[model samples]
Target chain A: GAGVSQSPSNKVTEKGKDVELRCDPISGHTALYWYRQSLGQGLEFLIYFQGNSAPDKSGLPSDRFSAERTGGSVSTLTIQRTQQEDSAVYLCASSLGQGTKNIQYFGAGTRLSVL
Target chain B: DQQVKQNSPSLSVQEGRISILNCDYTNSMFDYFLWYKKYPAEGPTFLISISSIKDKNEDGRFTVFLNKSAKHLSLHIVPSQPGDSAVYFCAARPASYDKVIFGPGTSLSVIP
Candidate 1:
């Protein structure tokens, strides 16, 4: 693809329901990241993948949140028992690698609204 | 504690003037800083960046300044245009980490 792509531009889910967001990073991008921005808040890191393995999952808010990347390509973020507070924009980004070239390119993001 | 902080929630600037956005970080280990501009219904796009080794970096109308001793950095846009109106985010990457921590963001409105 020409750029990072995300699925389900907007989602409206009832509280306690589960939702899954997907990201297709730019081809050959070695690094992928997940982040969320709540109302009046900054982009909070959720997780990152270096290839197929995630070196950092410390940012995941709770066990209800889980993410995985396969074949060092597409990635999926799953949220279980979504709460009202979970309403926010979920963003995905990809990078060439670490160091000076690590400037990430982002997707438009999926807006999730928990009703 | 937030490793990155943008104190201003919003700013207004007249077109053709300069718009400045400030940011501070609590971590001394941050070695790289970046500025991103985001518009409504769009993803943030990288603007300018300064490495710890450099005190300043500029690209055309956008310039980023870093004060390592104070753990502060700022972005300046000269001759601001209405198209420049957007939310600006400051982000930092620790020397030992690949993840970049971001500030709350400052919304800049460049009025024509």
Candidate 2:
């Protein structure tokens, strides 16, 4: 792809329902990241995957929030039993590698609204 | 505690003037810092960055300054434009941390 891509540009789910957001990182990129932004809030790191290293989940807000990067290419963020506060925009990004430490390019993001 | 902090929630600057956004970090282990700008319905895009060793870095109309001793950094935009109106976030990466920590953000309104 020309740039990082995300699925379900917008989602509206009822409280307690489960929702999944997907991300397709740039080709050959070795690093991927997931973040969330509430209305008028800053981006919050959720998780990251670097090559084969164990996915970093240190930033996940709660047990209901989880993600997986299958085969080092695409990722899925799953939220179980979504709450009203879960309504926010989920953003995905990728980089060539930390060795370069360049800026991470971002996707437009998926707006999730928990009603 | 938030390692990175942007105290200002919003700022208004006249177009063609300079706009300064400030950021502070509590952790001393951070090795790099960056600024990202985001518009409505869009993802944040990288603006400028400064390494811990350097005091300043400039790219065209944008410049980033780092004060390691104070654990603070700032982004300055000269000749601000209306197109530059957006939310700005400060981010920090620790030497040992692979992920970057972001500040709450400061919304800048460049008025004409």
Candidate 3:
């Protein structure tokens, strides 16, 4: 793909139900990131993965939020027992390398609504 | 805590005028700053960026200015056009950090 791509552009689910979001980064990119954006709020870092090393999950808001990058290309973010607060746009980005200078390309994002 | 802050929620500028958006950060460790432009229903696109070693960087009509001492940065759009009307976000990352912290966006309305 030319850029990062995310699945299920929009999702509506009931509270307490589980939801999963997927991201496919650009080919050969070494770093991938997940972020959450609420209405009128800035983007919040959720998780990061670099190559085959263990992902940086420190930014995950709670234990319910988990993400895994398989084969260093595609990633899945799963939220268990979705809450109303979890209703936000989940964004995925990828960069050539892991550093501050690397330019990150972002996907259109998946808007998830928890009712 | 909000390490990066975009105080202005919105700004309006007449067409052909200059649009200046400001961002401030409390973390001195940030060595790279970038500005992104986003439209409704679309992901953010990189506009311009400035490294801590330099004070200013320009590309086409967009320019980013960084003040390391004040921990402040600003994006300037010269001869703003209606097409430039969108939400602008500022992001900062330290030299060693891979994740960038974004500031609450500022909505710029370029009035014709």
Clashing pairs in 1: none
Query: Taking the tens digit of each residue's C-alpha lDDT, what string does model 1 give over B1-112?
Result: 8999999999999999999999999999899899999998888999988889999999999999999999999999998999999999999998776788889999999999
Ranking by DockQ: 1, 3, 2
Residue-level lDDT of model 2, residues B1-112, one tens digit each, is 8889999999999999999999999998899898999998888899888889899999999999999999999999998999999999999997765688899999999999
Candidate 3 colliding pairs:
none
Error of 1 at B94 (Å): 1.6
DockQ (C-alpha based) per candidate is 0.83, 0.78, 0.79
lDDT of 2 by residue, A1-115 (tens): 5899999999999999999999999999989999999987788999999999999999899999999999989999999999999999999999886767657889999999999
Q: Candidate 1 DockQ category?
A: high
Q: What local lDDT score does residue A35 receive in model 3, on the 0 to 100 scale?
A: 92
Error of 2 at B101 (Å): 0.6
For model 1, the DockQ equals 0.83
Model 3: CA > 4 A from native: none
- TM-scores of chain A in all candidate models: 0.95, 0.97, 0.96
| Regions more than 4 Å wrong, model 2 | none
Model 3 chain A, poorest ten-residue lDDT window?
Answer: A95-104
Candidate number with greatest DockQ? 1
CAPRI quality band, candidate 3: medium
